[model samples]
Target: MFKEFKEFMMRGNVLDLAVGVVIGSAFTAIVTKVVEGLITPIVSLIVVLTTGKTS
Candidate 1:
């Protein structure tokens, strides 16, 4: 049972999956931050233009 487990972990597929998950998580965070940054400025500009007030 220990040998079987060891062999399974040693395979490339599991390692690749772990790497993919980590990279995907990082990519999601970066994209979310970038979108928020861009949207906030545009939305603020729109509000200021429409309301004629800067808050």
Candidate 2:
């Protein structure tokens, strides 16, 4: 059982998964920043112009 576990950990799939997870995490952060910093403001401005606030 221990040897099987060790082999599973050493497989190429595990290594690829580790690399993918690291890259995905970085890409997610960049996308989150873009949405929050740039896209959200533009969307909010459009909504406000269309709605015409009463207050």
TM-scores of the models, in the order given: 0.64, 0.69
Candidate 2 residue lDDT tens string, 1-55: 9999999989999989999999999999999999999999888888889997533
True-structure RMSD for candidate 2:
3.0
lDDT, candidate 1, 1-55, per-residue tens: 9999989988999989989999999999999998799988899899999999899
TM-score of structure candidate 1: 0.64
- Candidate 1: where are CA atoms >4 Å away? 43-55
Q: Which regions of candidate 2 fall more than 4 Å away from where they truly are? A: 1-10
Candidate 1 — worst ten consecutive residues by lDDT sum?
Answer: 34-43
Against the true structure, what is every candidate's RMSD? 2.6, 3.0
